[model samples]
Target: MMACIQFLLLFCSFMYIFNVNPSCAQIPNSPIRSLVLPVTKDPATFQFLTTIYHGTSREPIRVVLDLGCPSLWLDCSSGRLSSSRRLIPSCSIQCAAAKPNNMSCAFSAAMPTRKRTACGLSTENSIARSATRGELVEDILTVESVDGSKAGPVTTVDHFLFSCAPRFLLNRLARGAQGMLGLGKSRIALPSQLASKFGLQRKFATCLSSSDGLILFGHEPGYDSIFGTEISRSLMYTPLVTSPDGSGSSQDYSINVKSIKINGKRLSLRQKGIGGGTKISTTVPYTTLESSIYSTFIKAYKESATNNYFLNMTVVAPVAPFGLCFSSKEVPSSMLLGPMVPVIDLVLQSEMVKWRVHGRNAMVPVLDEVMCLGFLDGGSKSKTSSSIVIGGFQLEDNLLEFNLGTSMLGFSSSLLTRHTSCSDYHTRMMQSTLKDS
Candidate 1:
């Protein structure tokens, strides 16, 4: 009897020892790298505008690509129809460790030059359209140098397929992200095909922020750095941001956070180091808020209490008190569902960099009220700029806020909506309950 009991206990212990954590199995590693790859702070992982100009005739097709994929081209001998057909194979390759970059190429036979009829336009209109089109042709040949050493001539590529959207869609792009490039870690993607051509490693990382439509791509540098005065300087003209106040003061300002409150009382923040020994510089500050924001949301949920319909305010707390009010549809609630933003928001103001213990692992705190207006084309060698404003704050502490001055706060006024098609359920509800009477 004793031996039987001992044997059973031993079996249970062995089973427990061998149990594997499902989460650990799935994630594979801690500190998962982001998809938008540029790890460097300077020149910050090239998201640049690329143009494919047909040889000699000066026709060009425009697109945006991560600079990390060095090899990108357009095949001209093939007409647009054939070019798209031929390039499909190249675009279909899988991205793997063995094959690093996803070099997806769209093709165009020639640049659009003559305009015929947009309803009814004559040759005079065509000539004006041609001039506008001429401005889109980017000169392919230029010298690329870093620290006085020539990386090479910014080569003019040919015989590749490039995509041009309907004219209206093209107009929606910022100056540079106007076209597509090969991203995605697939074999047919441009990054993999051009990996050897551009001396890129097998895998490039890209970090994409929904708040800002900025894609950072590049190999991780084994050093610590910062986005310096230069890159920030060039960002000004990049059409990425629109309607800036032009007062330079806002440029230097980082995020400003109001006090952190829990149950309406505030909390203090303290910094802690991340990596130790030689990696000691990485650090982050943390503080737990007293407010049971989740609890409040639960109460709202319970009061409204329909299993099919529920509400959650997606926000990182510790934002400026006023900035926590209005919500923007543009902000993705899922992405900001992390602990970093609110903790950082408690200490810093918009765009300001507050050192998190070690200068290495810092977070850029942004005002909660600020909303990002995707990309504006800052012209001439400029990348896109993300615009923000100072509106949309929570007065009762549960409202959503957008910092950008011109974003949609609550819904538009009923008077304004009388002329437009604003028939969303929320709009209808507001109309039925609040305005119809």
Candidate 2:
């Protein structure tokens, strides 16, 4: 009996050392139900940034939130190096999961001459259109936890996979941002890792604004009430479709836009239906439409503003990026939304499932006295690849939930209409929690 007991003890010790049981590796009975990241928009670049604590020392790293990127990568040359970081072997299971097609080790000038095996990954700067090779590595990642009503304590993921790129890749990104946090539909992306590690739902939500906003991983039922009505109740969902040309594995979130409308009237487009050429992007600053579509859209908007909203509004000289500009005095401002202007709608699967763009989202103030239409004209359908690219400005102050499990995108149009903005919601939540604490 004593020999049997000793044998059992030895077997348990081996299991503990090797982590044979995945459940034994995690923090037992952890109270964290969801993760929250604070999002802030850069004034100069107009790109949104989110903070995440990484490494054993818990270094806070600010990364641009890119909806199109497939993986998370940082500038390792200048960024702090974590002592706990470990490179995944080229032939390991983790490396296979990250890059199944490429198993060969990466070559870097910085690497030692001594032979070693490490997984190679290609990190790309979508803004600069540059690509660099990096090695796959895993380190501790910490994020703020939330339990619905308030922010909880920080939670740590034992092993988070990311690549380390060279410093030059940081060019064209927002100032102070060291990396890009990819929220795309890839296995190695942030949402996938968080969901897998925490056993949470495979969904994430983004709320972007000029000031600090919130990005929540896994649905927080409490946040649904921030808009005065449950956000889910107000949310309208549209099926997320894959890109054309048979690239179903594309990381970007795309939706089918049936038609475009200005002030409840549909615009006459060169193409009858825009179809599956609309995508959501946080990197692009303004909504971009194909040249032909833009021409018809701008003409319809001008007519609507002149005849209905702003009578005899003065048309000012065009801004550099905006083709249509109007005198600020002619446009009326609303306390709830923004400048009172004609609404723009992107009719989705059905007319009733329209993604409405109100005055606040459709207009941008370029000069003190001039406000211009926020939409931009992408040269042609061939050049742009998409008929409509929904950019960050249009997404600001809107709550967008990407449900990967259901392959659906849920959106709440202009939280300002609900008498609250993204920045306001985040500030209110923090203040209320502080008071309670």
Indicate the residue-level lDDT of 209 in model 2: 93
Predicted candidate 1 versus true structure: per-residue lDDT over 222-250, tens digit per residue: 10011222221222110112123332111
- TM-score, cand. 2: 0.89
List TM-scores for all candidates, in order: 0.26, 0.89
Would you list the C-alpha lDDT of every candidate in the order shown? Answer: 0.23, 0.80
Quantify how close model 1 is to the true structure by its C-alpha RMSD in Å: 24.7
What shift in Å separates residue 147 of candidate 1 from its native position after superposition? 6.7
Worst 10 residues of 2 by lDDT: 102-111
- Tell me, by lDDT, which candidate is best: 2
